[model samples]
Target chain A: MTTIITAQNLSKSFGSFQALKNVNLTIKKGQIVGIIGANGAGKTTLLNSILGLSVYDGDLNVLGFDPYSQRDELMKEICFISDVATLPKWIKVSEAIDFVEGVHKSFDRKKALAFLAGTTVPLDKKIRQLSKGMVVQVHLALIMSIDAKILVLDEPTLGLDIIYRKKFYHQLLEDFFDEDRTILITTHQVDEIENILSQVIFIREGEIALEADMEEITENWMVLNPTADNIDAARASSPASEQSLLGRTSFIFNGVSRAELEKLGDVSRVSLSDLFVTLMKGDNDA
Target chain B: MIASIIKPGGYNPFKALMLREYWENRRAIFTTPLVIMGLSMVLIIISMGLLGRAIHIDGQSYTLNEMIANMSAQKAQNISTHINQILMVSTLPIMIGAWFCMVFTALGSLYDERKDNSILFWKSMPVSDLQTVLAKLLNVMLVIPFVAIGFTFIFQIFLLIVGSFSTLGTDYSAWDLLWSSSNLPLLVFSELTYMVMYSLWALPVFAWFMLVSVIAKRSPLLLATIPVALVILFETLFFHSEYLARFIGMRLTGAHILQTDNGFGQNFSILGINTPLENIQSAAKPEFWIGLGIAAALLYAAILLRKRSSL
Candidate 1:
């Protein structure tokens, strides 16, 4: 596998507060990695450090160069779209687009303009005048216009409505993503991008709590529904997500074959959200 | 699957950032200098009325050619005082302009990007930290002064043109102000150069602001100004020190205006022998240059920090 990012022992502190503590991560090319965590769990900090926005004490290599020292050069080949409404409020949509065109060599003006085709974003109207959702659309259009090898999208759907968020990801998948491209997306809402992700990386308090392949996840993470009489048998299997309703136990396990899990009772595929919750709690216990 | 685009020895990313910032500001107020200068000319006419002065020249034949000279550096220190007042008062506004530009641009430069968490875009690029720092340094310290120069030059010209005509009944004339002896081109060029140099010398201040902007959570310019204000308060309440005043406190008042050795004239007094133009102190000194160098270095340090800083 060709490695796209390798972060080792990365740590960052803001005065009295430590934002990140000894985080390590490695991502491969042509893989879509989904990151999920609660707020203030150092998810943003990790992405920021990777992007070379904050000074951190650790080692970071993105596309084979130290992120801190090689930000500008590395940026040309990477597409980072954090907030949805990133364009300046004073700039017209077209002016902002034109400005990006002039600044970024990889920015495709025609593609971005085409993305806005038939939209109400009058190229002349200032960004402040546009609706909030429209602003997000404009920013997304600009991001997709740039042909970067790696894409880091941090909460790109924040502030966007449900419909737009759905449409946004759909369009992103339709137009931007491909086998040769890599994307790292971080969000608490795991179920939305579930189908598209090849891997799930769960970060908890500045540490990679879990990293699992999609195939392995379904294979191991099985929510078991069995009568209380068989709970002892299910428990013996080290079920990860086990619930008791009237002492009728339900369990999820990892590292067990699907056929083996069926022997326990009522084994089925686990949703990414269920998998994230189960894996986080079960951890090494399972 | 790793792309080969990030090889060593490629295009500089710092230059791209510099160009981006420059173009944004240039688009915002590219013609501001000329406009401000024209407005200043109108103000000059009003100032002439307040001074109750008429424009004329008597050293040669009474003509427009002779009258412009009278509008120049004082035939008697009267013009010097007027120029001094204009320079002294306007220094604040120009500085305000510079401060506003530096604070706004620097505030937006890294802070806005960080606020949006656009470090991802920047981080993926192949440019080095040093290049990023260099571009920011050049934008604030270099491009700003040049923009200011454009404004000052246009402002001076406006003053000369209207000041010459408004003094119709007095010692001022368009020809005299334009031709008589001032050598408008050289004088204006010298003044503009002095302005540029002063800004360059003070590059550290703007750089400091940029650093604050990059790291500060919010309102970096305001936050930074408090220290400068506290220094002044403490110095005033306690002992006096010229060194501190010259180094930091003096910058607060901005007393020195464009110190150019124009070599206009050598003054002689009736009571005592006068120092010749050659004996006068030069505008530039080693100490100032040293300070300038230190400031430039400080500005560069900000750039380096910004290069690696998230957002």
Candidate 2:
């Protein structure tokens, strides 16, 4: 497990507003990590800092290169798709392929063309003329063809239909992801990518509220459905969050043993979305 | 290996970036001059067809063929010189079209990307901000001008060939009168030299526009032009001198690229000279170099702005 990205005390501010607070993180190779946060929680800001698109205060390194100063050299191994439809609208599909082939050393033009061959995106049509889903497909086709070590995607499937969104992640996992590659993704639709992510980091108010592997999350976090009489006993375990619906209460507990939780009520594994909401709510409450 | 696939000599990144600039703005850089040339060719053919009818110039009536036949050799030489001059001057419209293309392209190069949020896509590439800005500068300063000149020269040759046919049955040899009298090679060399020098002279203006394009939030044209206008206005109001205004005017029109007897007429006389290289010497002055220094500084500033800018 080689560390590919290391951040120490990373912070960014615009005027008086701190977008990213004193943050520390380490991402290793061969891991698919999801950075989950609410709106304005500094998810995009963190991604920008990692991509060297924004300036920051504090030490950060990606693939042994300083992202800010050595971005050009760093980009040789790092590819990013920042939101859907970021590709220029005026660029023709063929021109886009030619441009990527010309600019990116690691780009495989034949693979990209092969990928596009299966789709309905016309090579002669400009990007603006394509539908939104088709544009994302074109962008994804180009990016997936690049033999980059790290793929950072920020809302890469935003505003797309469920079919396209599923296809996006499906292609990413099937064709792009491997032991030699890593992916860092951020999106509001957490459940859509939950199955693909090996690790998840929950951010709130510019700070990491929780970071854990999928196995660790399943082992340590549990959602217990407690009856009205057993609710007080379940609260004794210090649940992170609680929600009640139709006279039934679900309490998300962290670090409490399954045996202890089973004593109070029925316990079930915590879903990533449920754990994400629990951790974020706990941060807000604190 | 990927490195072998993208070896330095096999594909120059700078050249590719420049090619990308050309690709993005092909309509402005290549098509405008070509369309203008096509239209001019149609007009030239129609006007040549009308040459057979008698025409009155300065109250003297003569058919086009008789006018060429009746002139003395020296008089015909002068008429040939003037005719070549008119043909050379005919390229002005295309040149003007190219100039407008250069201005808008420079202004919109950085601004358009930022507006569309494609700056992120561009910044993600391995090319640095410095290379990107320089590629755009080269596009406006070198590529567009060269393309315009190439089209103009071809169109000029076509017109000269057509003129030779129109001048048949006259005493004057159309080959000697039009082609031989016109110093075509020297004319081309001077034009190329003039364009290169003019790019240097006008560097500050283009650099300023590019800087404005990167820095301004919106309406970059207004942001680019208002400051120069204010400077001229302030100079007129406070100092009662037009030096700043005149200097900007001269740079924009490339008046300082040559030592003309009169500022306006020397550009036209580029074709008049047999040895245009000797006459095309740039104005050797501290201001010229200083202006270049200013341009370099502005370009550097644009690169810095681009590095820091994000959507």
Candidate 3:
């Protein structure tokens, strides 16, 4: 697979505080990578650097161009949904379509209108008149209409209800994703998107804590709930994290064989949320 | 997908950017001029009714129609000059309205996008920051003034038609009474020339507003004003000079240094017909070129600020 994005020793700072510290990464084509991080954990800083919205130091490239210096050229093949409700409130739905069609060479007016036809968004109404869910719907329709190679989403469904949130991701996967495209997403709601993420990166305090493919993570990492007498032996295996819920204790292990973990107790593949929490706690302990 | 592979060539992004500005500020750019036309039309009709009454010129009473018919060649020429002056100067209100529109629009053009977080959406587009900033700048400098001029032309034509009707049932036809006496084509040419010259003269101020809009996080108006105020105050307090203040005044008012009296007040009497051609000569002044250079610098700074700014 072709590499779509590459960053080597990438760094950014705001006044005294450094936001991203020497982040080196390479994303391959057709990968849906989820960047999981807590607040002030440099997820946005990294995204901004990748999207060329902010200045950064060191080598960085996306789609064979330096994003910061060549953002206009990069944007011809890249589309992003940065946060929710970003469409201008003064624009009519029809005007937004016309503007994108007028400016973006890759934009398809018929495709945008056809997507809107399935929604409740009215063409004549201003964006301010639409409901928050409807606004996101319109935004999604516009973005999906563009024939782009990479799509970046930073909390694209922040305040939406559960119904719209599910629908948003569902539509994206069903209509937008292809083997020729790459998607990068950052969100607080990890579980909802974990099923679709092929790769996961956990960032903490301006540093990348964990980066692994979904299959690799599931194949190597496992969680176990041992019997009362075997708890001490399970602890000997050195779990990444341990959680005690009700009267049962569960231990999460990394790079440990399932046959070994099954000897301790019942073992199963670790969930992404569990892995995220484990990685975060591991960082805190260090 | 095959059709999408072919890039859309007919679509011009610069034209789209201009249209975007118009769409966003349609009220200020378009409706304000139309409202002025509507108000002026109402006032003209009211004055027409009042003029229907008998007027006494040298104690000889005559109706409005009879008065124009009774005028001699020189007398009618004099009245025509004053009427032309009134018509030309009447465009002042619309221009003033457009000036205010330009100032506020420039101030809010960059600030409002950041305020609502829509800058991210705009930045996501393929257009360069230079294109975006230039579009807003030209919208205020060129587009608004021309739109105002269009409404002024419509109003001027309406008034001339009304003048023609007033001359009916008398010796003078519309041509002799209104059309022939007025040099409309020359007047229009002069107005357009004056607008272009004035926009160039005032370019620095608008550019300053846009720069302030790009830099200020909150209260762009206050941020824009306080620095200039401090400059003026500082100049007055210690330097004992008003060069900056006088330059600002000259830019705001259309009084070029090339004029003998240094003001437009004495430039004309009954008609300011010669002002346009005279204004054209102001382009040769060093200050005019200097103002353009300053505007270019400010606009470049604005583009850089926008490129670096985050939502």
- Residue pairs in collision within model 3: none
Model with the higher DockQ, candidate 1 or 3: 3
What is the i-RMS of every prediction?
A: 6.0, 2.5, 2.2
Model 2 interface RMSD, one decimal: 2.5
lDDT of each residue in B1-311, candidate 2, tens digit only: 72343233323578668767876898888899999999988876765576555645448886667655654346756866666675667678788999999999999989999999998988888889999999999999998998899888998898778768858766668877787777777677777887888898899999999999998899989999999899999999999999878877878887675545464565544445433554345646566898899999999999998999977
* B24-60 per-residue lDDT for model 1 (tens digits): 5663234454455556666656545664444332233
For model 3, residues B1-311, the per-residue Cα lDDT tens digits are: 62242233336788778878887998888999889889888876876686564744447787766666555345767867756775787777788888888889999989999999989888888899999999998899898888899888888888789878877666677887678777777777788888888888988888999999999989999998998989999999999998888877778665663254444556533234655668688888888999999999999999999999877
Q: Which prediction has more favorable lDDT, 2 or 3?
A: 3
Could you tell me the lDDT of residue B22 within candidate 2? Answer: 72
- In candidate 3, stretches whose alpha carbon ends up further than 4 angstroms from where it belongs are A283-286, B1-10, B50-76, B169-172, B257-271
lDDT by candidate, in order shown = 0.64, 0.84, 0.85
- Fraction of true contacts reproduced, model 3? 0.66
**Which parts of model 1 are misplaced by more than 4 Å?**
A9-24, A56-58, A227-237, A244-249, A263-265, A282-286, B1-19, B22-35, B38-142, B148-182, B232-240, B249-284
lDDT of candidate 2 over A1-286, digit per residue (tens):
9999999999999999998899999999999999999899999999999999999999999999999998899888999999865799888888777777777877888899999998998999999999999998898898899999999999999999999999999999998999999999999889999999999888988998888898998898889998678999887767888888787889988778999888888999988788777777763332
Native interface contact recovery, model 2: 0.61
Best by DockQ: 3
Counted clashes in each candidate structure: 31, 0, 0
Q: Whose lDDT is higher: candidate 1's or candidate 2's?
A: 2
